[model samples]
Target chain A: MERPELPLPQLHAFVVLAEELHFGRAATRLGIAQPPLSQQIRRLEGKVGYDLFSREPGRIGLTPAGRELLPAARHALTHLALGLTAAREVGSGRAGRLRIGFAASLALTVLPSLLRTFRERFPAVDLDIQEMTTTPQLAALRERTIDIGLLREPPAHDAELGFETVLMEPFVAVLPASHLLAGQRAVRVEQLADCPFVLLPRAVGPPLYDQITGLCIAAGFTPQVTQHAVEWQTICALVGTGLGVSLAPESIRRIRLKGVAFRRIEPSTVRTRVAVAWRKNDPSPLVPGILAALNQGPPGRP
Target chain B: MERPELPLPQLHAFVVLAEELHFGRAATRLGIAQPPLSQQIRRLEGKVGYDLFSREPGRIGLTPAGRELLPAARHALTHLALGLTAAREVGSGRAGRLRIGFAASLALTVLPSLLRTFRERFPAVDLDIQEMTTTPQLAALRERTIDIGLLREPPAHDAELGFETVLMEPFVAVLPASHLLAGQRAVRVEQLADCPFVLLPRAVGPPLYDQITGLCIAAGFTPQVTQHAVEWQTICALVGTGLGVSLAPESIRRIRLKGVAFRRIEPSTVRTRVAVAWRKNDPSPLVPGILAALNQGPPGRP
Candidate 1:
């Protein structure tokens, strides 16, 4: 309720710390850096607007408010841990349920084949999948609602979540099927210099968005953004409506919309990388299994 | 089991801090300095042989050991405060009770007069008195069992307990009734150089014992300590037996031993001062009342 947010990891930190009362042990239990664990508490105090512990020089104690807050905090954490276990149990469906979120383009390419190979390797494991952009996938991974995430342009700088690229593909030119250059084998990026573009919002995938804009910049012109859509299929449908042209991951070619044309971008150096990601502290067994499946073989339309 | 003992004030500190969870508020509640409060906790942790609180930079928590110790510590503290309350009630008999401890010699002098005036002012206040040495009196004061202490050569530097000098008297040379020095109205300290002395051990009253030795040294001799007694009356009776002569406060003359003679020390510069001591943070009404009454009159045989 106070500004940006109270991060959830800090809640876990509070409960463990309250029980242990020792910093070194609690940090070890939390599997986090000890220094960050302390910083997290200060930030949490800032969010809580009241301190949970009395940090006198030679002693530490719970204030009245802290004592009062203890039961509730314990309740939330215990229930959360329980819910995680229950959800984990139900999700796995005896074998295990792996909830996965992926970028729109990945669904058309890596998704089907990855699922096929994963089903072959672990047939009993249930696959619960959702279409998501890179931004929301990261959030889902952190919240632990999804055990694994398959998304494009994974944030390499984020140290809290682990990521491994599963696929890399160059940009393709997407235009209305009836466009004048639709029959060409490939088109130079500069050829679309005057065309209006349809693009995903930068917030959804900052790195990919920057790469697309950078490609246009390198080609000596900025494509006028005429519209936006979160899904590649929607972007293609909009392009099919003769709305605008756009440059996107090559995986967009697999969407198969009748009126949309995908052509290679000449000198196509701008590319998008799709990566699988998960919370670093995620305890789910399915996470590693899924990662293994993603790397077992080259994915394709089988 | 450890050396120097675990200070009890630290225990009180732990409970209050454990409850408040905030150093500033806990310090205010304890009526103690904030800086020392932290130091007290650290010392308490050392006594515990385990950290009771995790003092991470931005956070503080109780370790499992701390959590386990909480209930017991709370029990000890609650009962102590309650016992103190019950004792206070029984001591005062509805008005208020004041338990006092005094240096052994004061029982023969300042003790009786101070009690009479104090009783006169607060007629309903119950009086419980004990004759104890300075060291034990300090322990009793810290334990909160005794409301006030009347002792000699009080430690002026003790920051925890407040001291007010109530009476000061010069040393008297105590000797056998038939001794050569017994006929003199007064004697210089050097005159007792050859006599064996009866005195209280240094352990019972360090400063007083030091003063006696210091006075003898200043007079170019060290009175040989051939006998020791805790009470001045015993010292007088020992002197009566001709076992030894001793330097004592003038108040020792009031003991009226049959075979002992008391003569004022010539200079009178060497004196023993009796002080009323009480815990600074003591909340009882009788303590201040007794202090006022003690200051109200000049103590004497009356």
Candidate 2:
């Protein structure tokens, strides 16, 4: 057999009446007259084919049938309200989760601080961070699995991701302190045109490697690159052995090595930019906070 | 007048039967027998004093009232389900916003890359970032307005914000190429201890300034500081005037300034760390993404 149907207005009246136990109060809460509230509840009971409440003169209470439905009715109304609120919040940019896919390298230098500051400012938000390559980050973002990305340089497939320049730094030459040019007053890139260099792997992408190569060419000659290492520290270690010279960011000086010497190149050529990237239509509440922290760093102590 | 009540079992039966449309299917869906479903509907009709359905011996259809209540019932159920899901997700650290506060200085070098990587990995998460001073960042984190922070060293009120090291670099001296130290192999801090020094302002905090002072003291004298600037590049410009030497990170080499020389200090003593900070008990979803990014940096990029 099919279930009985009840009108929403009548059911709503029944719920309010059930709570207030009085037509006058329920009507007031519903912004309706007392007579109409009573009529609606009666109509609701009639539609359900059940006696939802017992009335004796001025007193009224729920019948067994009415008692059984109170919880479910309340539950339905609450959920409806919440859903509406959430929809509004999402549209206003005040809520919703931001799925992010990122390269692993950002975790060490800037990601921590950026994340910390972001979290400290927006506590009522959700975040999903995943480790991914630039290719996957872009792919996932396009698929709506992620909303933003942290990447180096511009992607070969730039149409999919919106890139914003955030950080940029020039490359420094790492050599042994005892090298003949180490004592020179600001060495020129041409001075090391013939020196063997340790470089990032070819797999890192030709664009970046080509950038370094191009810089060397602009400095007057091609570099004699000997080894390829993925991490900057490894390249510095090779340079410490006096085997060759390598180019890295000035930040590398922070990672001390016993025999490594860092020098600025004249007519600086290789500048690397790390960027914040996101899909054009991505909407995540955390995006604003993360961006703000990135621009401002963390708060002060005390 | 008193409003009538609604029967619990009848509402439950109504919802299930409405979805299934057949007594046997509805009963099966509700994990109950068809007889009970029938009995509950009859009881509901008795309580409401109306016909909720038009029943023909072997078939049934909802009355007008039934149509109106369907949406409300569905809404309530959805909310109940979502409430439970949200609670579980928040407890598991898989959802919820992370508020963050930060200072302006970090925006340049490290913040952008971190935020970009985080957004890419956690597109469904929310982040809130606030730009503030170091003191306010710490206070906000403590007051629960923020979940994390990013700032420089000597953080005040260790009792409030927990600090973690993210990036560290040593100070290098910036001078004019025409200066006497430009020709030196490696100048000690004491060599220009009495020379006018361009220093960062006290607003940046005493810890940092003291570090510079401490380095000079360790080198056997105090620096004769003259001008004070707010930012690193500004101090570098002052150094370019041949007025004095300034200490800064090797990263400062990125800024192009005519007639400036960068030199390494012997027995280097000044080092600065950029850190990620947060309250001890923050339970925001954005925290994990940020933490993951900070620990790994961007993924796949060499």
Candidate 3:
């Protein structure tokens, strides 16, 4: 006879029977009534095409077939338990991968500490980090191509996305140290109204680009654009050459470029916020652990 | 919060949800109503200490935590399925061990074909073979030390023991080829009643010893036992030296001892029945496959 498929429940029952040997005892262990257990055994026997137990007047004994199934049943149950444990470990963020998309600016600021803390806490978790802008990063999150994104504050999109603001820093003016206003502790936005400014293009980061231009508009004059740079390092280099002044996040002061002076903006409300974004409804087990690691108790908060 | 232990049901549910992000679709896939599915998701979230799904007005999406859990859940389910397959394979005798005890006589008889067939059918099964007498073989079966036995028919034991007769061969008279009666095709048991005999002691094989002694008694004269030997080869060698004549199972003729000739007994009812013995109620999965390999189709029958 063709052997029928062995279901997990039946294998589990068989293992219990092999352990107890008595139907009443096994039934008690399984939390089921004796008759039902007996019926299940009968069904198992029908599938196996043999009697697994011999029914004598006073005692029940395992037939040869039943003895052979004992080890296998135990093995299967053990593996099932192992699988559950694996899932739990992955869910707890003690294991598995965390794919992250990061903006280039974070490398000099929060990135090192964040990565170090995550590594120390979840050593087994593999981090897949990709440098991406806010828009593409959010798009990647929506498409499920990435698990988490670290970027500057972004324009609002679908409410299904979640962004946790982790850092906020005041804008600062970067100028050549030899410039006439370099000695000032702080530069007012209106004082440099006619200054030719080196800045990033809107296509590079639309939200931050608009925030800088809006600050210029707020100062009563549209600054003449002299140079455009894709990154902070390039803008700092141009400013050191006395090309023009550029508004940058306070965290950018760490660069310490030669001949470049960083002075706080008079209206410091022109600041940048960095946030972590993800699909609000993502059911990934690793995300919570990653979020916990990313959390630094509201860094740079006012 | 400490990570709670993940249960199998919850992990299974997580796998389903990871496949279908929408609660309604996941609930349908799980064969439950949406509310209970939501409850299960809530329970999973409680265990994980985070949200797995974003609760938006219309669309469902995986939270970072949920995305992290997806692959782990899938792996766990796949492992569970693999474990079940392993159990089934073992239960069907395609894997595991078969412990067997056998009498020395079968080595030259049915053992070769039996082992070859068993190996061809179940290459992964480990065979544990021990050479033993019928009494000890039966004892091993009772003690659950061995799964199968190939031995001479033994005396009745407890009802829990089972015996299946596989080989039956009439006894034959073995004598020196140069002896007066060696030229004869057949020798009457009554004629050899007064001849000197070389036979194994009763302690070695009581059942066979009693049968041989009873045959002499039936022929009306007791054979004078001239020598004793522990093994069939020793007895055959003694008979070859013309020390005496002996009656042995017909399969023994295959030995072809020098200076010894085997002749059929006039009354062939004096036969040896070699059978496979096992515990009647042994529940071992390997027994059925071994039994099938041993059934050699009614040996020496009309």
DockQ of each: 0.01, 0.04, 0.17
lDDT of 2 by residue, B74-154 (tens): 555544345334434443444556676665555555666777777777654567877765656666776667777876674
Candidate order by DockQ, highest to lowest? Answer: 3, 2, 1
Candidate 1 DockQ category?
A: incorrect
Per-residue lDDT over B19-73 for candidate 1, one digit per residue giving the tens place of the 0 to 100 score? 7777878888888789999998999777556566766455465544455456655
Per residue, candidate 3 scores C-alpha lDDT tens digits across A1-302 of 11125555666677787777888988888888999888888887777666667776667876645665666556545654554455456666677777899887777677777888878888988889998878789889988889889889765666768887788778989999998889999999988887889998878688888888889899888888889988888899999999999898877787878999998888888678888888776666566666787774234322
List model 3 lDDT by residue over B1-302, tens digit each: 11125555766777687667777888887788889888888997787666767776676666545665666555545654554455456666687788888888777777777888889889989899888888788778888888888888666655867787787778888898988888788988888866799998878688888888777788888889989998888899999988999988877877877999999887778777788787776666667777877764223331
Task: Write one digit per residue (lDDT tens) for candidate 1, span A130-221.
Answer: 98888888888877667788888877667668888887788899989899879898999999999889998889989899999999999999
lDDT of each: 0.75, 0.67, 0.76
Instruction: Report the C-alpha displacement of residue B252, candidate 2, in angstroms.
Output: 99
- What lDDT score goes with residue B26 in model 1? 80
- What's model 1's lDDT at A270? 62
Residues forming the 10-long window of minimal summed lDDT in candidate 2 chain A: A1-10
lDDT of 2 by residue, A1-302 (tens): 22224444566677788888887887899888888877887776665455667675586776545664666556655543443345345433455566666555455565667667666666545668777645556667777677777766656456656776666767677888889988975778888898998987756545557777777888889998888887767878888888899776555666678988888877774676667777653433345656666789853111
Real contacts recovered, all predictions: 0.00, 0.10, 0.13
The TM-score, computed over Cα atoms with residue i paired to residue i, of candidate 2 is 0.45
- The number of the candidate with the highest lDDT is 3
Candidate number with the higher DockQ (1 or 2): 2
Tell me the interface RMSD of every candidate, in Å: 18.8, 16.8, 7.2
